[model samples]
Structures are given as structure tokens and as C-alpha cells.
Target: MKSNNEKNPGISRRTFLYSLGALALSGCDGGISAPVTPGSRATSRVSTSGITLAHVANGAADVATSGAFAHPGLLHTQADFDRMAQKVAAQASPWYDCWNVLIANSHARLSWSPRPQVEVDRGGSGAQNYPVLYGDIAAAYASALRWKITGDTAYADKAVQIMNAWSSTLQILGGDSNVDLAAGIYGYEFANAGEIMRGYSGWAAADFAAFQTMMRDIFYPINVDFLNRHNNTDITHYWANWDLCNMASIMAIGVLCDDHTLFDQAVNYYIDGAGNGAIAQAVYYMHPGYLGQWQETGRDQGHNTLGIALGGAICEMAWNQGIDLYGYDNNRFLAGAEYVAKSNLVQADGTYLTVPYVSYTNVDVTQPGFSTASQGTIRPCWALVYNHYVNRKGLAAPWSTKFALAIQPEGGGGNYGTASGGFDQLGYGTLTCTRDAVTPATAPSGLTAFPSAGQVVLSWWGVAGGTSYNVKRASSSGGSYTTVASGIADPLTYTDNPSAGTWYYVVSAQTATGESSNSAEVVAVTALQLHTYLTFDEASGTSAADATGNGHTGTLIGGATRAAGHSRNAVSLDGSSGYVSLPGNVVADISDFTIAAWVFWNGGNAWARIFDFGAGTGRYLFLTPKSSSGLMRFAITTNGGHGERAINGNVALPTGQWAHVAVTLSGTTATLYLNGNVIGGSTDMVFAPWRVGPAAQNWIGRSQYSGDPYFHGSIDDFRIYRGAMSTDQITALVQGS
Candidate 1:
């Protein structure tokens, strides 16, 4: 029988060996060789307008040759493991065991299977797995990693075989519900494996070319389309994970295909994309001493940690390409990483603290430490983040370091215990991120201050090596800076009681070394005024009273009953049988006004009005559901106009989940906000102004038109201000609730 090299003619054994030798020689000081730079034959095919592919190609060469930068460089090429194996009979590190676990699994799974059919399954709680897709990617990546680490021909051949199978088969991504996720999570790993093995001497040029076509044809489009659509103009709002995964996928594929535009697209979203992907949307600023809130922190720890891991993966890949995404946005990702670590890890003693989490129905619950968040599962996620934020950047992440140390001898994630579709980013960090290093503390940067409803909010950039921050405030700029807050953790934002005069603020970094110099001063002045406020904490059978001094009291009609609301008490409305009648003239005098309410909608798949203010059609201002989609639509028929001016919310008012929905109509334009994020808006409209019907017809949860829809959700703390509330005020309200 002929050898594998003899069977392939595109690349000879001699050429491959020479390339490997050159790769080994090029890893001097962990930088790429001069020939590998832009316009070189090695990266001529890929665009390099804003990003360079040299780092990726160099990492591959290093893996192929000296294996110096081989510690999880898309593919592992470290020869130290082989050296350790030669020196000791026992495995040198715990990572070796996990690596062996993958090798053993890949060794057992020698056959490759792929399907040519397309699947577009959508609209289920869980996603549809297509042709055992992610499983196949896992196997292929494991085989590729094993091949690079161990120099095993069989593993390399198996990985190539799997790639060949998928290239020739598999038509479409599996489902609709989480297609972006499938494309992102699976596409990233798949592309990584493909990128590594494309250099194999025995892999035929035709086969490699065909696989490239497969990636472009199948995976690339799915990610691009989902990312372009953003929210797809719907109420089924895409979470941060969806956007993060797609960003990861597009970026990985872009690197694989040498497409700079694609790479830039993903990075752009990471910086400024709206709703998701952007750091602002993913992180929540909190008071002193508390870790910044992860987007999924209130949801669960499994997702929270996974998000960190995946986001860290994107940053790691970018870091290899010479982009400092890890350190971007004042090291916000580090804050999220530490938050998850501190929330989930056991303390020095046996006892651990519980992290407070807010549920979907607006209920606050404390999650037990280390075990109960995300169903008490430990996802092998600490290594990458630890390596980047602590190991590489020399930042102080005590809790993250502790958690990574605790999950020692870290293993792959599949079936490790209970988690399924578990990612396998294990062991590499333990081998790579451990180093003796120290960094001096620096002053925090970008100190900023803004006034919100009833408070002055101050935020500043986080220092790289800081564990906590100190915020000082005073009424004057030159002197008398009192220590109003100290030891503020990551996401250095603080909310203080509003005083009548201007407030001056400055923040400093606190690390193991000491407190750094103070940041530039920032100032804020109280600007927001509440016109009307209703807590809806009325007696069971009485009227809903306005907390705002301006009397806009509402009479409970049709037996609307009092119950638990957003924070305090609420009033429940029956779609057909209940509604609240407010004084008609309460909102009649204001031209630019704001209406905000905390709603727990139970009106399933129907048009239901939350607020209606006129006696006939085309004569009222109303907020209602846009049919079965469950999205809220705010309409204003200016003084019985000919056409209704309205803007529909992009986010759905999900059933059973208490959501804060607010609409601000400034001049003729209307903007809708959900949970403090801008969802949608209408630009132009012509109407007379604000007006309401006689007393009986002006209602909450009921409309005056004969066939108008009545709301079936619980309403709490309904407020109508004389002027449109500023975005900052809306944000503060959502945070306070």
C-alpha cells in the first residue's frame, strides 16, 4: 500500500517539511516574519484594509513548526506536551488528561457522516439539531487539535475526512428559532478546524477548495443575514448571546476566508451595534462594592458564563490578529468575567454568598453560590477569560483567578456531568495562562457624570490592573471632595442622591499596590422633574391614586383588582371584563408628554389596549398590542385626525414577564422604549395635540371605540409626565424598578 503523501500530489512531503521548518524559525519573539505581512503570497488572497491575516497565518505556521505560540492558536501546536510525555511516564499536567480525553474520543469516532438536505426548523423553545451538526463540528475540532498536538496522522486524516464529508454534503443550517446561534457556535469551531487542517500536506487542493465553497455557501450567509436583520423587526428580541455568537461566527469565517470586510463587520458590532453585541447593552452599571451585572446574570449563570467564554473567545482571536478587544471599553469584559467568577465561586471558607437575581416576572431571587445558578452546573469556561484578563493583561481578577484554580484539571464540556451542547474550551488556559507577572496600578480614565430622575449618575473607565474604585464628590470643583463612595468594583458607575447645586466627581483605581491618582473631574446638575407618578398601591376595591402631586387619580372600574406589581402593588385587568377610568382632563393640556407603565401581559395573541384616551376611532391617543405578535404599538390621533400616527415596539411584551414599556412623543415624532433600550420610532406625523374624551371614556386597559381591544395585563406604577422623559430618566426608571 502507498503512503498518504504518495497518494496526494498538490503538496509534496519535501515542500511541507520546508514550510514547517520556516514556520518554526519565524516565531522569534512571538511575531510573524516579514514575508508574511500584507501583500505577501501567504496573505495575498485575503483583504487587509483595517485587519491583517498575518497573525492567523503565522499562528498556523507556528503550530505546524516550532509549536511556540501553539497554546490554543485556533489550533494547538505546542511541543511541550510531547516533550513532557517523553520526560515522564505520568501526564505532565491535568490538561493533558482532558486533551487525551478528546484524542480518545476522536480515535474512537473514525467515520464521518454528512447530509445534503437543508433544514429550516423554527419557533420552538429548543433549537432543532441538523444532521448531528454541532456534534460533528466538535468531533472534527477534537480530531484536528489532537492531530496538531500529537502529530498523529490518523487524527489528521480523520479531521480531513470529516471536513470532506461536510463539504460534499450538508446544505443548510438547521433551524429558525436559533439559527444564528447554530451558525455562530458551530460555524466558529468548524471554521477553526478547517483553518488549521487546510495546510495538511496530504489534503488535496480540490477537496480544500470545495470545503471553502461549502463554508461560504452554507455558514456565511446564515450569519450575515441574521446579523444584518439584527432583531428582524420583531418582538422576539434576540438576546446578547445570539448577537455574540453570530459575531464570533462571522469573524472566524472571515479570518478563514481572508475577508477583511467580514472581520471588520463583526468588530464594529462589538463596539457600537445597537440592542446586542455592544458592551453597553451587555453590561449593567451598579452601586459601589457590587460587580457589574452580566446581561444573563439575572437570567442564569450557565448563560452568563457561556457568554463570557464565547465573548472572550472572540477577543482572543482578535488579540491574535493584533486587536485589543479584551482591553476595549475600559476592560468591561473583565468586569463581566469577575462578576461571574465572584457570583459562582466558593469563598476561602466553606460558606459562600448568594447573588441576587431578578426573574422574568420581575421577582428578585438570590442564587446560592457556586451551585444553583444555571441549574448548578460548572461549565468549563474560566480558562480563556482568566488567560486574557489576568494572565495576559496583568490585571487584578482575584475572584476569577480563584474560580479558575478551583476548576483545576479542567476537562472538556460534553457530558462532563449534566450540561448538553457544552463547549470544550478547556485545559489550554491552565497550560498557557500561568505566569509570574505584576502590573502597576494606574488612574481610572473617562470619568463622566449625568443627572437622571432624582439622582446624579457618575461613571468612569475601569483601570486594567484595578480591583476596585473610589468615587469622591463635592459641591465645588477646586476643593472639599468628600468620599461619598469607595471600593466600587468593575463597571465604575455610581448613583447619588440629587442635591440642588452642581455636583463634582472624581474616581481613582484601587488595586493590590495601592490607590492610583484621581481621574479628571466631572460635574452634574439636577435636571429632571417628575410631573405625575402613580404607584397603583390602592385598596383592593378602591381607585388607583397618583403619587405625583399633580392629581391624575384613576377609578377602578369593572372590578379591576389590586395585586403585586413591578416593585410594590399592581392592578390586574381582565381583557374583556375589567379597566380603569382616569380623569379625562388629566393628560389633555400637555403637548409633549410621556407615558410609561410596568406591564405583565396575560392577553395571549391578541390586540389589547393598555391606555386609550378618546371616545371614537381616529380621535384618541392609545397604546395597544399589535395583534398576535404581542408587540406594543403607541398611536396618537391628534384631536380626531384623519389618520392615526403610531410607532410599534420592536420588542414583544412577552407573556408572564413583567416588562417596562414606555413611549415618548416629542413634537410630532414618537419613540418607543422597552426595558430602557430604544426599540422603534416614527419620524413624521401631523396632529392637533394632546386631548381626551369625557370622564367615563378616558380609560386604562379599555378603549372608547365600540369594538376596541381591552388590555389583559397587570399594570403597575403607571406614570404620565407633562413633558417627554429624557432617555436618562427612562433608563433610571427601568433600573430603579
Candidate 2:
């Protein structure tokens, strides 16, 4: 963060900080990568022309609040328990043995007892009763998992009893500075145990509420304080594991207590917090072969391995609640996990293998090389992470898989040892994280088919042990299919020139054994040509050429000049006089249309049009990054602003980043989308584009209102489709098609 990103020149130090400094990851529940949600960040700066601009943030950051959280969403969710119960009941090998380990443990037995203290301290000069607290935490969590798997009231009663003892007796959790660790680590653990048992009828309503209160009152304060202040030291002084545990506690407790504020807080901190736990900071540097160097790699292997435990916990929690932090920052955590796993693994000859390393440093200290102290460290945290990427997402995780197998049939809390690190993560992956049964043998997965202006593009995650892929296509949903392409090897992708019709596609993997079954299906409809396509790739021209065969080429009017675009060259507008003028009546007659473009918002005045097509203010269809009401507005008016039909995004367009903005009109329903997620829509509209008559002043960046200011940033790949596309197609547009 202190230096420019020389590797990815697209993300300069300033631009990256501006883009992701305050943003959170946003996308569908299980997307390949987490895209951005425009945030409402405003900062003032003087422009080159001496204009003082209050630059608002655009794309490259946060999702809106979840509005709601799924119940029992923490380290484990309902689905994970269900999977465990089913596998164990069927006497499955790994899960059944894993269950045996759980039932055999003293903490999981009905004979377990609670040990609580009014003040538990971990540092010097105080009652060091924190171990007692960690012990009770283990008992409570183990009993809760047993109850979940067996549907036994006895285990639930025991879990509730342990929790009640802690909540009723614990009032003050104080220590020298290490209390933060006690608070963060046990705070998240206790909350997860409480979360698992929240649904138990044996645990009465009042007692459960008291447990919630204990987590909120007794634990949350320290967790938030540590994250916010970092023990009053340099922000980078604390290790990544410290910030991670606190983040996990905040996120888990938020879900347990049903608080979106806490949930968003943890998520925002993970993505944008100026701490060691943030993605870019946690995985500080990328090395060769997709390995990302963990921030604590130089400190010690014991602490370095703890990062995987905490990060996996955070990612799993977010994934269960319909977010994709697992793939956040293009899977930086996976890369770091691979690096850590390779560095800490044994190489069959009773010797630790050496791995690549990049010297990591911060304000507090510097480590010029990797540390060999406790080098062969192994943690039970690998299974959950390995299963997610390989079995769940069909991506390779070689070292992650190796380490998980090394620690197979993982038991929670007490199985590793008596140390605090053993209890730091909620283990038991052979039972909860194993997905070998349903792992596809023949089928490739994560199939995506995107319909573009003239063609359809297809891609998928590779099947394990597969050598090649066969791309199959059909005219209808359930084939009757034929091979469009076969024997695709590396870089698993395919493009097809289908005729003007709807097409269904799937991919099958060619394993050494044989050709496997087909993957999940995807569809594409390629009918309409790009009505008015603006490439804006003319680097030095005043004419913004139209790439569509149609002759709706645009002219760079005022002072608009060619600048760096989202994908290629773009048109840069100077906020006042700069704008693009297209031929008259560009989209004046289309009934169903889709308009999509990539925008770089420089925080201009309100009502600056990304595009406006109309003869006058009374009859126009325009999309504005920010409206007078401080929201992104897409309005179509035949009778003026007051009488216009409009759809507004939840927030204004963020400034200083490239955001994919799109609007689709299907029948009377006009929807507005940012990135890939739908932000707003209007369903009662009756007017169509033809109703606006012959639009004479079809313009980009200039609004219909004479008083409105011109757009202040850049626009690229502006396109108009003759028909409104589906959500999947809009998502494809987000992928830069």
C-alpha cells in the first residue's frame, strides 16, 4: 500500500487505494470472483484545472448491507451439519470415524462440566483463568456439534448449560493487553457454539437471549477496540491473525445477534480495513506459481499457519451467508494458503521443503527471509479450505489437499493439543468439510455461457484429473445435444458462432478413465446486433467511431479528449464543456433496449448524464451517476423531470474507479444495474423510446437540461442492444464482453 503496484500497472498505488480503500466485495452468492458495490465515500481534492472537486467513490468496493442474515451462520451453517448427519448416519468411512473421534473426546461427553470466572485474564499480574474459559468453550462447542449431528437433547442440554454458566457468571474480561486475544478468540468460539445451539428447544428463550447479551456486552467491546485501535501501537504492529480473529468474532456474533451493522462492519474491515488482516495486506506479495506470501511467513510458522485457520473461518462464514469472500481479490487467500502449505509441509524424506519467499516488512519490523522455527507445523484448518476449492468449486488445491490428508478425521478444539492454538479454530473437517462422495468424476463444473454482440463465450472450472473438455450444445434445455468443440486442453475456454437463436451449452471432461458426464447447463440467446456500439478506441481522433455495422458514429464535442478507458482507449470529459454527440435519433424508436457502458466517475455535479437521448428536456431517456436526490437515477420522460418515470439505485455512483453501469428495459419494467447486481427498477412505466419522438441531441456525458453539468470522467464500450437482455447476459457485460 505504501508503494506503486509495478506488476499490475492498472492499479497504481493511488488508484488502488482509492478503488479498494473503502470498498467491500459484492456479487452473487457463489461467483467466480467478487465484484464491487459502489460506496458513498466522498473526498475533496483540487483538480489540475484548479476546480475543487468533492470526489465520490464509484465501483471497486462494498456491498450494501445484507438487510438480513441467515440464522446459525458462523464457522458452520445448517447445510454443513446436514451433510455431516447424513454421511455419519450412513456409516461413511471418514465422517463416521470423524464422528467417533468427536463422541470419544471428554469435552463431547455428557460428563463435561463448566468452569467460569468473573474476570479472566491472559496476561501477567492477574488471575490467569483464561485456560478455564477456553476449556468451557471447547466443551460447549463440541456438545453443540454432537447435538446437531445426532439430534440428541442431552448434548443440546449440556451445551446450553455450559453457555448459561459462562453468561451468568462472567462480567469482566480483563487482562494486561492479551485480554484482547482472550476476547477475540473465545468470543468467536463461544458465539459459534451459541449459534449452533440457538435452535435447540431445550435451551429456553430467555437463556438464549442472555447468551446473546453476554457475547454483545462482555466480548464485543474488546474485539472492536482491538480492531479499531490495535492496542494503541502502529496499525501494522499486530499480526494478521489478531485482526482475523477479531473480524471472525464480529462477523459470527453479528449473525448470532442478527445485527447487519456488525456484519457489514466485519466485511468492510476484511476488504478495506487499514490493518494486517485485509486481503491485500494479509497476502502481502505474490510469488511464482500462484503462491501468495502470507504476512506472517517471516515471523514464525506457528503464527503463519494460524492465518489459514482464521482466514478460512471468515471465508466460510461469508460464503454460508450468500457472499463470496472465498473468491475475494481473485482468491488471494487460496494463493497464500498454497504458499503457506508448501513452505510448512514435509517432503517424505523427513525434511521440510523449501519454498519461494518475498521479504515482507512494515513500520513495526522487518524480516528479510523465511523463518525455520517450528517449520513443520501442521494445522487441522486445511480440510475446509481444500474442500471448498477442489471439491466444492472444482479448482486445484494440491498442497491444501496434502495437508488436509495429513490431518484427516480432524476433531474440534481439543484434538490438536492442550495449547491455545489448538482451540483457536473450530476443526472437524473430515466430518463437516469432506465432499468426496458427490465430487463429480466425469463432469466439469462452473459452466458459464455469455451471449455477446455477435457471439457467445463459454468457460468452466477444470475437472480434477481431466485432460481435456468437450463442449456440447443443444437448441433446447434438455438435449438432444451435439459436440461444438472437443479436446480443449489448457485455459479451459471456448467461443462459438451460433446462429440467431437461443442455445443451451454444457461441458464434459475427458479423464484418463473415460469421458465424464456433462456439467451444469448454461444458455445464450444471440439475436440482436449491438445497435449503437462505441468502441472509443480511437486513441487520437475527435471521431468516436461506432463498431456496430450501423452508422451511428459519435463526435467528440466540446473539449472531450481520448483517455485511458476501462478496457482500452476512452473519451475523457472535463466536467463542464466536454461531452460526446451522437447522430440524431440514435435510439428514438426502439421498444425494448439494453444500454450498457463502463464509466469512470470523477465526482462531478449532480445530473451529469452518462448518456441522454432526446430532442429536449421534456422528452428524454437518460442515466445519471448521481441525481439531485443523491442517488443514481435512470429516467425516461416525455413530459419533463417531475412527470418522468425513473428508477433509482440505492446509492450514488462512486468516484475514481471503473464501474460497469447498465440499464435494461423489458416491456414496462425498466431495471438499473451496477456491476452485476440489480440496484433498482421501475415497473409502472408506460412510455417507450419511440414515444420520445426523433431525439435530435443524442449525447453522452451531457444531460438534456441546459443547466446540468457535463460528465467529468471517462466512458468506454457504450452499447445499445435492440432487445433487453437477461440477468445472466448483464453479468456477462460485467465480465467486459
Candidate 3:
């Protein structure tokens, strides 16, 4: 009976949607409309949406059976498994190897031995031999998939017999402290078997109903309560994988029962409620100058990769329901995959690159500087992450892609690592998800940067399979560099105006698959006066106090909160309405000026502002997004009024990921640089001396327009200079010089 707003902040936004279940079940005398046909697509998937058995069952019946179907349905449909089997039969490259391992291990499971009165009891310690029951569930589902693919009714009959025995005889499921774990992991697999078999015309309707009853009674409650309350722990208290598994369980049950409310609950929890369920919070941002860091970065790669796999399973279920969790939050999940893959990589020198090892309680688990460790345990976990990021998103995932390739010929879970005992059988990806062929773009080599009086020119050797190039720079060779330019196609050279300092640069190729590795390092130097800088390092409070000691502080407005930055703390602006207001006249009188900052944008159709400073009607300088394209647009009204000459970048700023943006004005010219390369500018521009209203009208994440132009993004390391910066100086600034 709790209203959505009445619940604690810990409660998620999806609560309101799911809470309408009661009203939905009881159709109003004069209702808006009947629930949209389940199998047919709805105009919109709002709270009022409803799905039927036909909708959830469509996956199992689809003529061209594919993976990533609705819940309750098997992970791979009939056609999907058939293709895998065909590949196995032909002794294909990767599929046959995985199939060989699976067939070898699953020979004994061909016969069904259903334990109807199975009671897996873990002592109070929450550890037990429940894998036996879960193992049976895995076997049943695997057998059912084989039956559908091969048209072997014996496999189908065995799968049916297994479900029938459990439904007719199983009376109770308890005795384990971690009984919820059993319900979550085992229950979903069982439900999926029932879902696939439900499509079999031979399976008695009565028996299928009985199985559905069993799932609803024995598994649904446990899984739902666990996800909602986390075993009476804090809502966000459980381990990431535990929460993910339970979410998967609920989603499966929801699909099996044709309950859109329950399905929505799982989606909402993953996206909003469970803190660890979100990609941003679940995996910590990579430190500004370091590689991307996952929440479990300090943990072992086994557990970390397991988290990605389970989470992917949940998202896959959501995807079947027409949600795109895989692409959500700027594809934040990719960072975790890359982080784990990079950590587990074997270097040419035979050493492993790893982060510090920490325990579940955040305690250091290894000696100082010896925290780096690699399990080198391979499992069938790579496909889910790989198919989504590399194949679907078209983003580079070099480490993960390589790891997925190395683990090709993947077998069942018990063959390695913590996934022993039939936990994560993954032989399907090689057959179902593997690309026919992938020719990755080669990395650009021999990058060089030269500094001139007002410009820095960067050139690199081009390679094949590349549609464009990405330019990155850092102040020091060891510092983490930010992308200065992206989508620079052809002519392999770029020019920029920057301030003075030591600068390091690199170039990378980008193709349809992903980005290539950074080319060889190159350095450049320039001379420009360093000016006001604000790192926004404080983790809490309302002030973005200036780190440059120029005393130009910013006040956080509305609900602006601190968020992860390139290297430290930055302010996050709610897309609708939140920003940081700076004092007027802070840098008002400058004739020539350069401004730069690192930004992480959450895209919207609206014009999202980065920085806005100007009079409502007169001379103004503002940076905002252009509608449709959402590319970075910098404009200045030197003569006042609505007429404005703006430089709009050809390449849209990369959302979710951080990039450096700088704009400098010297004489009558204003040039904008993304990362460090010049993207857009004009030569025939009139100079406008700086001026501002006495009121604090200038802001980050908001504009001084009639309707608020609030930015839904994060900004950090903001710097402003009294004079225009040379191209090399801008490169140095972007490189953290």
C-alpha cells in the first residue's frame, strides 16, 4: 500500500509501475482499453501494458528459432540449437570443439532421473550440496534444447518426464540457509524447460499447469522476496551476482506466468532499485589516469566475469520484452567486461595485468603491491558479454574479444573455476553467437605531434578496416589520456590550438567492430598561461571550489550530486533540471580566453547544455547540443540579438564515456576542440569583449535561456585562461599536462 513517493529513496522508480498490478487485474467498469494483445507489439510498453501466454510462448514456436527470447522459453530456440548441432556435426571451427566437450560431459544425463522429494540442505553456514538438484534442472533444460533441435521425441519425453516427476511429487523445498539461491538458480532453469516443453503438442495441458503451479508456489515467492528484501538485509546489501541471479529468476517466472507486472519489477530493480544492479554503481568507474575499474576489480576475475554473465542473462530476458538494457547507461556494462578481460590477459612478457585484490568486505586480500592475481580459469561466460558489446554495440572490446576467441570451444561450467558442478554450461555461444568472420581494424602507428605558434599538428600512419581514427593525448606518458578527437576519417592528420606544456598523444583506428589499440606514443610541447582551474574534487557539498586558487567558486543548484569523474569527483546534472551556478564577473574582462572541461553526457533529444554564459539578450558564449544529432555546438553572439554564428562539430560527443572539450578565442576567431583536435571553427568572426550580468547567470549544466537548458551529464577539471591557448597547449591540457 506504499505510494511510490512515500517509499524511502532506496525504493526504485519501477515500484509505481508494479504496484498498479491490483487495479490492472480488476478491470474497471469503464476501463481505458483491454490489455494489448500479448504476441503483438504494443505501441508503448507503459505501466498499463499486459502480455499473454502466447506472447511469452512465441519464442518456442517461432519458425526461425533464435536465442534471446522471452523468459520461461529456453535461451536458444529450436532453430538456434539446430544450427549449433549442425555446426557440431560438421566439425566446424569453434562450435564443434564446444559441442564435443558438452557431449562428452552430458552422456550420462541422456537418461532422466528426477528426484521428486529433493531437499538440498545447507547447514546454517548457507553452504550445501544443492547442486545435485540444480544439476538435474540444468540437465533437463539442456536435454529439452537438444530435443527441439534434433526432432528427437525421446529427448522431449525425458524432459517431460523430469518435469512431471518434480511437479507431481515435490512437496517442499527448504532446509538450506541459502534456499533462495537454490530457488533462484534452479527455479529459473526448471521454468525454462517447462516453457520450451509447453510448446510440445504432446505434453498434457494438465501436466504443464501442474509444473507452472510448482514454479509459482515453490520458486516465485522465494525469488521475489529475495530480490525485494535481499534476505532481510539492506536492499542493496547482497553480492552483485546473487542479486542478478534472483532478478533472472523473477524475470523467468514472470514470463512463464505471463505476468508483465512481475517482469517489469525485475527490470525496474535492475535499472533503478538495486544499487549494485546498475552498471555505474555495480562497476566503479576507472580512475581518471588508470584503466577502467569494475566494482570487483579488486576481486578475482572469476567472480567479476561471473557477475557480467549473470547480469547479461537478466538483460537478455529484458531485451526479449523489447527493452534495451544492454544499450542502457551508455553501454556501461562494456566497461566491466573490458576491465575483467584486461585483468586476465597474459602479456607478452608472461606477466598478467591485474588490479589489487580485495575481499567481499573490502579488505585487502593480498600483500601490498602483490594484490595482482589471475585465476586463468576459463568458463563459458564470455559469449553473453561479447555478443552484446562487440557484436551489437559495435564498440571496441579488444581484451574481451580476444578472451572470447581464446575460450572458443567452450564447454560446460564444472570444467573450470568456481563454476564447477554443472553451474554455467555455455557451449551454445560458439554455435549461436560467434561471428562468421571478424577482421578488426589495425591500430594506427607512428603517431607524431608538432607545436606551432598557434597550432599543434598531429599525424599518424593509417591502417586497413578503419572507417575513421580516434586521437588521444595525455600530459605525461604515464598519465591516463582522454580522447581528444573521434571519427576523424581520411587524410590521417589533425591541427589544433592549445596552451603551452608537455603533451603526449596516440591514435587509434575505428571500424564497424570496435576501436583498435593505441598507436605508438608521441609527445609535443607548447607555451600558454595556465589560468583558473576547478577539479571538483570534493565528494560532498554544494560548492565546486576552485582548485586553481583564483577563488571562482560554483554553487550546486537543485539536486546536483557528485559523481565519478575522469580521475576524481565531478558534478552530475539531472537531464531535466540540475546545474552548478558560478558567480558573475569571475573571468569577465578577458579579451582572449580559453575554456576546457571533461564531460560525460547522458543523451536526450533536447539541447543539453555544457556551459552557458551570456546576457539574456546581448553578447553571450554558450556550448550546447544540437537537436537530432546531439553533437557539441559552441556559439557566441558578439553583436547581441538572436543572430549567432556557431561552430557545430561533425562528430557527436561520445555519451556515457568521458571526453575533453575546449574552446579558445583569439582576435576574431573562435575554434572548438574535442579532446584536443579542432572539430569546428570560423575565421571571419568579430571579437566580443567578455561581459556578464551581476546576477549569477553563468552555469555548468544549464543555460541562460528562457526555458532552462539543463545538461544531463557530468563535468570535471574545468579550466579557463585569460588568453587563447595554442594547439599544443590544448593537447597538453587534454592530456592532463
As for candidate 1, its clashing pairs are 115-170, 121-176, 235-652, 371-376
Q: What TM-score, to 2 decimals, does candidate 2 have?
A: 0.58
Each candidate's root-mean-square deviation in Å? 18.3, 16.4, 18.0
lDDT of 2 by residue, 1-737 (tens): 00111121223322332333223221111111111222211111111221111111222334434445777778777888898899899999888988888787788989988987888887767678888998889899888988899899898999999999988999998867777777878888889899899888888899999999999998998888888877676666677888888888988888999986677677667764656787656876544344778888888898888899889988888777765677665466887898898888888898877776745555545677899977877777888888888887766566787888887777776575312246776677778788863354457654655443346656565666677889999988778899999988744678788987768888888887889888767666566546788989996878988887678899999879998888789999999899999976566435567899999999967888999987565457999999888889998864455436789899778899988899987657888999978999988655557445445678999987899988999999999886677889899778855
lDDT of 1 by residue, 47-71 (tens): 3322222332222111111112222
Clashes of 3: 21
Rank order (by lDDT, best first)? 2, 3, 1
**In candidate 2, residue 206 scores what lDDT?**
97
TM-score between candidate 1 and the true structure: 0.54
Best by lDDT: 2
Over 4 Å off in model 1, which ranges? 1-131, 150-154, 175-180, 230-236, 274-278, 284-292, 297-300, 346-375, 413-441, 445-504, 509-515, 525-737
User: Model 2, residue 22: displacement in angstroms?
Assistant: 20
- Model 1's alpha-carbon lDDT is 0.58
Write candidate 3's Cα lDDT for 233-329 as tens digits: 4333444666666677777777777766667666655543433444433554422111335554454456566666666677666655555556443
Please give the distance, in angstroms, between residue 222's alpha carbon in candidate 1 and its true position after superposition.
1.9
Worst window of 10 by summed lDDT in candidate 2: 44-53
